[model samples]
Target: MSKIFLALFVIILVVFFILNINFPLKKHEIYGKYVNRNFDKPICCVEAPHTEDTLILYEDKTFESKFYGAGTYILYNGINPEIELFYKDFNHSSSAIYKTYFLNGIFEKPKIMLNADMNHYYEKLD
Candidate 1:
């Protein structure tokens, strides 16, 4: 009876390991609505135009942006985490890559900066 119990335990452990390998868990903090408020200012320069764009990140690893349209996102975890956006209708081509960072060391106030331009960024809306 003891041997049978040990064998069952081993089988359960193997199944759990396989499941984790096949589907890894993802971070949930990055999912939210981010907006660029600089465009709302009346006194806007050539670099920052007068426009309002909002980015919504879903828990399913998908995102929708006013300017970028709808697409799926992949988060690369490391020292500096990065998000890669791929447009759904663009044959899975990469549209943009954003580097995530916290503002004033506040985790709740996270911001995603565009890799192409440091000044261009989206702050999480509380």
Candidate 2:
């Protein structure tokens, strides 16, 4: 009976190890720096001010933005995966606001679109 129990335990451990190796937890695919694609800038001007609005998403589920301020974000996974940003403050002013934006394109380089509008979107920076 002791030998049988030991064999069963070893088999279970091996199965668990194999499953863990084959299927791991999915990492956040949207963690990266994204810049507003519509920001106008001079192409020929090397000294042009870098005033493009930027959004930075951290691995810890926190995000910082030039327009929306710093706060935590939730990524809703589905057929139409969306990201909800809870703004803590903006421009030193305190206000509680949350905005939902749709994600488009591939996982490697996604465009965060406003209200499903493709024209108004932030492209992930490589």
Candidate 3:
């Protein structure tokens, strides 16, 4: 009886480990928990990074973004931007810069920013 019980326990443990490895958990796949704001009209939509929450709210006459589970706002005062993006591996002191390319008309360079930059270049989906 003891031998049978030990064998059963080992089998259960092996099965559990196999299942866990076969299907690893993904980061923030649940969209309902990630809904930032409901708007009648939105300028742009943010495709959030893994394991993080993306929030873009209108404040101080500018669109500010708070990312990485942190509720700090990043100013967005430019015209229609090419895109919005964020970095999850920001090791800087509570701040970092991101640069992205935009479809600037017939011929133009990619829009760039130094620190705390968020793009507003795309139309919010209907």
Candidate 4:
């Protein structure tokens, strides 16, 4: 009985590890950096550290602008793909805002059209 239990535990651990490393969920399709330019450029603010604006969507539904900072993002995939990022204040104030963008094209070659900025769109880069 002890050997059987140990073997089962080992199998479970192996399966978990494999799933984590190999088979990520469909929701993880947005896990990547979407950038407008090749180089970093400041977008959110003038004093922003980065030069290029880049949006990063993680597997855990977290996001970061890199130029501004990290935040939490939500993707509502449907007939019209939508993503919203709740960005934390740069000044460390207890303030956050949600910015929505429409996701376009395939997951691999995605382009995000920002509701705030109608002029430009962010393209996914690997």
Each prediction's whole-model lDDT (CA): 0.61, 0.63, 0.33, 0.61
> Candidate 1, which segments miss by more than 4 Å at Cα?
1-26, 39-50, 88-104, 115-118
Q: What TM-score does prediction 1 earn?
A: 0.54
In terms of lDDT, the poorest run of 10 residues in model 4 is 41-50
Give the per-residue lDDT digits (tens) of candidate 4, residues 1-126.
999999999999987765544222245555798785423333553332334687788888777786547878777776566777676666778656555455543233556654223334567787
What are the per-residue Cα lDDT tens digits for candidate 1 across 1-126? 999999999999987766543232236656799887555444423322246788898989888985667878878755455677766333345444433442322223566654223355677785
**lDDT of each residue in 18-88, candidate 2, tens digit only:** 65431211345578898877445334322111357788989898888767767888877665666777775
lDDT for model 1, on a 0 to 1 scale? 0.61
Worst 10 residues of 3 by lDDT: 24-33
Question: Of 1 and 4, which scores higher on TM-score?
Answer: 4
Better of 2 and 4 by lDDT: 2
Query: Clashes in model 3: which pairs?
Result: 81-120, 81-121
User: What shift in Å separates residue 18 of candidate 3 from its native position after superposition?
Assistant: 51
Query: Which of the two, 1 or 2, has more TM-score?
Result: 2
TM-score of every candidate relative to the true structure: 0.54, 0.57, 0.23, 0.56
Total backbone clashes of candidate 2, pairs 3 or more residues apart or in separate chains: 0
Best by TM-score: 2
